[model samples]
Target: MNVCDYRKLSISMSYYLQLFRNNAGVGRTGTYIVLDAMLKQIQAKGVVNVFGFLLHIRNQRNFLVQTEEQYIFIHDALVEAIMSGETNLRMEQIQELKKSNSYLEQQYKNIIQFQAKDIHISAAMKQVNSIKNRGAIFPVNSYRVHLTPKPGEEGSDYINGTWLHGFRRLKDFIVTQHPMHHTVKDFWQMIWDHNVQTIVMLSSLDEINFAQFWPADDTTSIDSDSYRMRFLSKCNKSDYVTRDFIIQSTQHDYELSVKMLHYPSWPNLANANTIYDFIVDVHERASDYRNGPIVIVDR
Candidate 1:
């Protein structure tokens, strides 16, 4: 492979390694510790087959390698290694092998109906606004937090939010779309009502579709009737934008420290590997606040 291809493969390898642990229900730290020890053992002994490696790994530490895709990932790694100028396989042979593997992958996906789901997603279509095509939150996994509006309001108090459960039954986050101009007040109301400590805004304010809910200047603050949120500070990373916020209740004396981790270069899915560090940082920051759920604005 060329230099660019080699670099891409290296990035993919790292991403797949992380996914391997996730598939086996291992935490980030545990994955690193176990993989480090396993690699050392492999070096001491000799290279082994996929099953043999997995067996040794399971023996060394308790893990669950769930799903065929995880196993296939390991197989792909072996295939990649075999084709990395390490083996004497001809170009034609390598191409044929890759074609066979692709066929098998497609067959596996087709058997499982991986692309076609016979479930109804249009049941809540009535609640979806004109601007948002896929805005309906499934009632089963939706957040029940509704704004207690005063007498004269016409619309329902339901905000477009959903409770996102974290690993090991930890209910850690509430994710919602970017608030429209009409729903800005409702957004703040939801934050105050839910006692949300961290607010992760994942959209760029400069985007035409996105509304500038908060003031652009860090010196300025935005205030709702019940709450006051100010831009405390910001740190710009290579892959994402991080901002600290101080939200205080105008009615009550309580306050909250919010961290907004915004990744603007999304939808451009090439950033999947590039944003790994940013994602880790977000996780680490959110883990600090154990009392309240973090609000993730996905736009």
Candidate 2:
């Protein structure tokens, strides 16, 4: 197929449909490939870690599809090529990576690249240090997570979290900073309200940056707003610790069980095989909450 067949554009798209799947040019074709890789990774494991996907595609060329704008060019061209009834290439499989080189060329104004200046102007965002990770990291207002305020806790719709688009099977994932002492109540509220079943705590429970959000001992219970958590059991693993909890709402006659997997240590890429096995464990444990958005906490 000729590289010039990308003139036609279509709308019905993949996980990228909400992000980018239109416009003209070859664009960053690697995005489609990376997204495809992401989908397969998630489909097989029931979830995905960005770092894992990055490492999987490291040796492959052109996997850096950063922005949504990059999705359309290559995706459209691939669609057009397949729609044109090209019999020579495996269009269904997206086997034509070389033909997309030309469409990948693009440039943008410096103003669009950096939003640091824009974030400095917002009052709430500037004062986010109180709620977030001490303002060590700033979030885009457009992408920030807004928790629902409890009954009388007006202006409680703030958390240092953001929703990210997930691949094929999964719709969205919430990423937030580690729950601070003051914000632990808010964190539990978010989990209870949002119906989060599986929480992947990537950060270790170190004293400095990360803190333990759940009950420290098996006999004690922790209360946050209307929710109360009693430690059920702890399962020790090689790279992580799986803790189960029985959470009950003090207000209503409702109780929800939550499973948290905390990584005490991480295996490097050198242990790719081990990581894949770990993915399977996470997949099985998270099956109960696969329908809802998985909450991920980082630094």
Q: Write the per-residue lDDT of candidate 2 for residues 164-200, one digit (tens) a residue.
A: 7677444367888888878887777778777778888
- Residues 101-201, candidate 1: write the lDDT tens digits: 76657545544542211122222233433233235443221233456665675333556666656664435777787887766767777777777767777
Clashing pairs in 2: 26-103, 27-103, 27-104
lDDT of 2: 0.61
The window of 10 residues in a row where model 2 has the poorest summed lDDT is: 103-112
Span of 10 residues, lowest total lDDT, candidate 1: 114-123
Q: Any idea how many clashes model 2 has? A: 3
Q: Write down the TM-score for model 1.
A: 0.52
TM-score of each: 0.52, 0.59
**Which runs of model 2 end up more than 4 angstroms from their true locations?**
1-131, 134-136, 151-154, 168-171, 267-270
Computed on alpha carbons, the lDDT of every model, listed in order, comes to: 0.59, 0.61
